[model samples]
Target chain A: MSTDSDAVTAAVLVIGDEILSGRTKDKNIGTIADYLTAIGIDLREVRIVPDVAEAIVEAVNQLRARHTYLFTTGGIGPTHDDITADCVAEAFGVGIDVDPRARAMLLERHKPEDLNAARLRMARIPDGAALIPNPISKAPGFHIGNVFVMAGVPAIMQAMLDQIGPGLARGAAMLSETIEARGLPEGTYAGRLGEIAGRHPGVSVGSYPSMTQTGFQNRIVVRSKDAAALGAARAEIEALVAELSA
Target chain B: MSTDSDAVTAAVLVIGDEILSGRTKDKNIGTIADYLTAIGIDLREVRIVPDVAEAIVEAVNQLRARHTYLFTTGGIGPTHDDITADCVAEAFGVGIDVDPRARAMLLERHKPEDLNAARLRMARIPDGAALIPNPISKAPGFHIGNVFVMAGVPAIMQAMLDQIGPGLARGAAMLSETIEARGLPEGTYAGRLGEIAGRHPGVSVGSYPSMTQTGFQNRIVVRSKDAAALGAARAEIEALVAELSA
Candidate 1:
């Protein structure tokens, strides 16, 4: 009994030692999450592993097994530490080679003379994988099985996602509404909010307490696939916040 | 042989349906990363998973196996959907109960009558877990094996981290130094920086490019355990930035 729904589910695996060391603040996770949601694909999980092969392999295998699609960033660059492609290949029980199609794409931008050993490393792809077009650079990311490997750079990753996201399977669109409460401590409204949230089984409510230069602010978010349910929950939340403020 | 060097390594698992749906932007990942780094623990891997039992269980098991410590934020609140504590118990193959230690801490702030069935949900802990003191609210986070379950609220999570950080084992402190380049594109200095990085095997060099209202800026970070190597690398990086700017 397949629902044949458009809902697409995916997970992201970020590969880099630099992220772990706190040397780099990852920007791709948020961007991808936003983009995937816009395309109606739920980004279910994100994992950041070092450039180590075993970690990458384990994450790749586990995420791939769980999600309908998997998107991996980093470790596909030309540097020596870029081992994600190899690890992904190993995880999928496939072989990797400098694919003629990938090499052709690389050769389109860089001259054969400029394509040094380091640059050539970017052309390697797992066997039986299709290329994910990269608009920023000629060197393309590739898709093997259900896994799509893309660059770590935000711009490049965005471009690759633009090329591949449209073709992926997607589910029902998730909807969200936010209600703002001024100068409210979370403790003041947490109980009533919990009651309202519990009453609405389909809606998921989150309380975010933000600090401004002036004072503390709480933003409550109610999200659900059912628009009417979301509206009802939002109304309750607004009423509760008004009562608390009064 | 205990190296006497405190070696603290942590992996962060972010649990929330909002993150997966892209309804909420994650502020907790960066905050926890910065906190762990400042407290002298190597913040290794970060995984963001949906509020699903199987997904949470898989991530908890994998990360707990790999890291010396594990910190999970989100899904530990009083809501029915906040299933992190239960999922964690299943992952560890242990029973969960309203732990006395955690309930005692909660009792200090919450009135005995006010500790309703919903409020009591936060006190659930895995078998044989120790409470991690929470300064903001007396309801403490509990540690079962290496996994320390914490709240998703940035302020509350920070408070719990402050309490538990000192007791954890830490590795040799990771040190970093920065050299700033004015109005430099990464490509301009990429080759030279790669050469310098090659020269110093111990130092991990990363070039971060930022755009300001004025112009572009590139910050080169040199990180290593060895003080002498780091100093040398910093000098070379400064000189390189100067040369590039000139």
Candidate 2:
């Protein structure tokens, strides 16, 4: 992995019909987003597409071209709908077949006689890709170019993510501080918050308003890659909250 | 709001930096997905983009052009980051300003004196749009063309969806049945499942594998608009499972 220090940005492409059909609520997007942020990689965008090969191929190509890295989860199992690997290969204009390395990983869990044609489907990897080992399940994920493909199951995806995490180049980690507005609603402090955000170009300020059982709860979040800028913005937001509360 | 019987589809655009930063776990995408499915509007795709004007505008244009309807959540608030409405207007190349109807709705919740500039921002609506009433906070969402814009907060978004749902022209509602594989792993039944899926072009079959306390739990879900096709696929899947188990 090249040690580039630029702002590392990533996009997540969740491939599944289950998620779009609401059969499965996606836990992977949040997990991946949190993981990328913690690793100093900014998660810029996310797209959820159905199991259609055309949709999958188009999304992979579009996202991979724009972001520093594109991570995909789901549609990699041993069923008819599991067509992500082929779609990714098509997206990159590469040939795909059962890789010996991936087949070896499957051997750790399945006996040679038990590895049927369907089971061997799990061993298909795009040409020139590196395997991302799955500790929970023997079926490995793979990364080609700047895209990482992993399992849809949260547990297996987590394991694969851990394996892929170390090799990624680090960027300046974004620092953030949240200041709760307590009882003060966003309408009470939004004007001033906007002004504060405008003044701090180095930092991004966001006021989130959510409804609690009692009433509206609001929070002001300040984020910046620069530590001093983050601190300054957080201080201003805290003071704004204090003034609004008083 | 034509009562057309053709299959209706939608795409959701979630706009917020909080979600991208992982500061907030997104609840809107799943909620919208389930709602759309229940009403016979197939949720085709979902995109989560940050609070950037260019990104929001581009996504809005792309999604609205492709799907039968486009639903957007978040960024329609009273802060600097709340730029969704403006971005949407820019996407459609329409003029936008505070609408009288939206302002009237806001008046139900906010007093004239309390309707500050930031609060007034909630009343901004694009040209030639119909208002979606918000009962909770009374800051109405709106629809211009095929795109419906709603709040980021779950409660407010749900209310707006309820208002929008009754007017939508629904297609045939998809019917689904899930068959449990008991202790049978996907690898055991994947081959037959693939054959069954291939035989039934009218229905979609998906095999999902999850780990439980006992071990792996797998389920085969068959969905189709035609009940006859759904039943045919389900029966074949059931027979395959029994044969494998015996």
lDDT digits (tens) for residues A1-246 of candidate 2: 112347898999999889998989999999998898888898889999999888999999999998899999998999988999999999999999999999999999999999999999999999999999988778999999999999999999999999899999877887788898866878889999989888888898888888999888888888888899889888888887887787
Instruction: State, as a TM-score between 0 and 1, how close model 2 is to the true structure.
Output: 0.97
Interface RMSD of each: 4.7, 3.9
Q: Every model's Cα RMSD, please?
A: 4.7, 3.0
Instruction: Give the per-residue lDDT of model 2 (tens digit) for B1-246.
Output: 112347798999999988988889999899988988887888889999999998999999999999999999999888888998899899999999999999988889888999999999999999998989988888888899999999999999998998899999887888889999988989989988999888998898998888888878999999888899899989999999999999
lDDT of 1 by residue, B1-246 (tens): 011234677899999877766666777777777767666677768989877788899889988997888999988766556789999999999999898888888799888877877678778988988888877766678888889998877788888878887777766766888787767655456667778888888777766544466744656777776799899989998888788677
After superposition, the stretches of candidate 2 with alpha carbons farther than 4 Å from their true spots are: A1-5, B1-5
Q: Assess each model's interface with DockQ, reporting 2 decimals per model.
A: 0.32, 0.59
- Residue pairs with backbone atoms closer than 3 Å in model 2 (clashes): none
Q: Which DockQ value does candidate 1 get?
A: 0.32
- In terms of lDDT, model 2 sits at 0.90
Task: Tell me the docking grade of candidate 1.
Answer: acceptable
